[model samples]
Target chain A: MARPLTLYYAPFSRASRGLWMLEELDEPYALRLIDIRKGEQKRPEFLAINPAGKVPALRDGDRTVAESAAICAYLADRFPDAKLAPAADAPERAAYLTWLFYAASNIEPAVMARANKWDVSAYQASWGGYESVIDNIAGAVRRGPYLLGPQFTAADVILGSMVRFGVSAKLIPNRPEFTAYIAHLEARPALQRAIKIEAEYVAQLKT
Target chain B: MARPLTLYYAPFSRASRGLWMLEELDEPYALRLIDIRKGEQKRPEFLAINPAGKVPALRDGDRTVAESAAICAYLADRFPDAKLAPAADAPERAAYLTWLFYAASNIEPAVMARANKWDVSAYQASWGGYESVIDNIAGAVRRGPYLLGPQFTAADVILGSMVRFGVSAKLIPNRPEFTAYIAHLEARPALQRAIKIEAEYVAQLKT
Candidate 1:
């Protein structure tokens, strides 16, 4: 048997992107859900894996990778068959890589600040505040159907995941631009599978 | 002649990382210093190139890459002769890619929040607040000399830049572990040259 890849995740958390990444890749992996509500993630054992005490950490063979975007980046590179990540020399790779870092570095943080109503100067914040981020993202997708032109790569998976979170949480307004972008990626079969899995997980939590 | 790589830089800003990245690669790149103090980065021409109006944006060939870490990631892959990034299949690459995203995605935001004294909860913040970000970084470096075992790749250029920013800004204290880790990377000649250049630029401003 292959050294099984394991992801310590929690539904509806950032780890959903990691889970969704694995789902998109069609890879064999085990989902080890860490219950944040019950304080399971804070346990010593969990900290041993990720001192940050966050989900979306992955145990692949002997190495471990954490952070949602990081996990997705790793998976894209690790599973070359998925072609989720562009090759090093591909011109499209520039936009692909930029969007990957941009999502986590700018979009996520800015959205959090916006929802919390923090008084940050949009110009000072790397993400340029929530509205600027929305504008920047809209401008990118308006250029094409996906971030990297026509390719619906892992960058989309991560960005789409954040977009969905933003919409559902009402942090990102339901602007026609964002809706259209999400609609484009949500139409993918692999993404649908991951959504179904999360819906089931959410239902289980309710019952 | 080589569609010269140009970095839109500003002394003491995140652009220093982009400069250091080019310096480390031994690639000749033009420095287009944007005087953020004079609001040059916000100039219509500059904004036309990068709407974020941030320093440390890069124009390589016909491609433009913004976001400090993104520029570093792009250069690492674009100019592979530098050996800054690991092969796609290398196990260490996972940790490498993870830390690159971590620096920009978490450490930068968390440090900014701390320095500004933003009334943000550590738990709610995406970077998990300042202290957690510091602790997590310490744990990663504690494992080895670098985030990716022994190799000093482009990941170091980005992370080292942030570590230096953190300690200098007093946002991240002069913890012995951090100081030691930075000492390991700060000893590099390329970094030294970049620092010297920034110092020169700062001196010019004084006059």
Candidate 2:
């Protein structure tokens, strides 16, 4: 048997992206919950898995990968049969990697700056500014049924989760493009399964 | 002959990471300078290449990849003959991709938060905290001649650039590990070439 895949996860956290990715991959995996509310993620044992002490760290037997985008990218590439990512040699792979990094590199930092009211100069910040980041996502999704046209790769899982979370948190303005994009993602059975699984986990935690 | 590779670069900007990556790949790529100080990067023409309007956007034939880490990842994967990254099927690829995403996802944002003195909670921020971020780098580099141990991969280029820039700007503490890591990277002939090319460009701008 292949090494069992395990995801260190916590609901109401960025780990949801990894959870959604797993569901989309339609792969068998074990979810090890880390309770962020109880500071369980910050505990030593958890930190051993991911030095960052964050959830969504995926362990495949001996190897562990952290960072939400990285986990998604790793999983996508690992299970090429899922067709969740373009082949490495494919021409579209350039744009594919770009959007994956863009979600973490640009969107996350820009959102943080905006939410915190940080006065970082647009020129100085690698992300430029919140408006530009949002605008770029809006433009890309508008041009998309997916980020790289018709194929909904792992880039969508990473970027879509960010946009969905941002709009829900009121951190990102609910532009028509974003709303339409989120609505489209909502229609996906994989995402629907992810949402249900997350709700079930959250419900279990409360009781 | 393969299609030409072009680096849309700006001196003293994040584009230097792309330059270093290109040098490391040992590939012939044209450098297209964008003067950020004069706001040439903000021009409509440049924005068409990278919606973020940032430097270090790399174009391979008809494809353009932006974000410094993304550029490095793309180049490393596209030219796998250089062995700058592990193959998709290689077990080492998990840690490799993790470190690539961690550079942008963790290191950059943490540095920005620290520089701005943004009052984001350590737990709330995806990066955890500036201290943790720096500590992780220190711990990783101390365990390495490179991030993934002896084999020098693109992760080194992305993370090393952040740590090196961080130390130079005094944004990151001058820990011995960081200094040593930067020193090791400094010894690279590729990095040396990139630095000389950047200096020449900056000198020309002055003249």
- Candidate 1's TM-score reads 0.94
Candidate 1 residue B92 C-alpha distance from true site, Å = 0.5
Fraction of true interface contacts that also occur in model 2: 0.89
- Which lDDT tens digits does candidate 1 get at residues A1-207? 644699998888888888788888877888887888787877999998887788879999887888888888888878877889887787777778778888878887788777776778866676776777888887877766788878877788778888888887898888887888888878888778888888888887778
Across B1-207, the per-residue lDDT of candidate 1 in tens digits comes to 754699999998888999899998877889887898898987889987787667778998888888888899899888878888987777787778778888878887788777777778755666776777888888778755777778888888888887887787787888887888898888889989999999999998888
Worst 10 residues of 1 chain B by lDDT: B121-130
Q: In candidate 2, which residue pairs get closer than 3 Å at backbone N, Cα or C atoms, i.e. clash?
A: none
Give the 10-residue window scoring lowest on summed lDDT in candidate 2 chain A: A1-10
Q: What is the lDDT of residue B105 in candidate 1?
A: 87
Off by over 4 Å in 2: A1-3, B1-3
Candidate 2 has a TM-score of 0.97
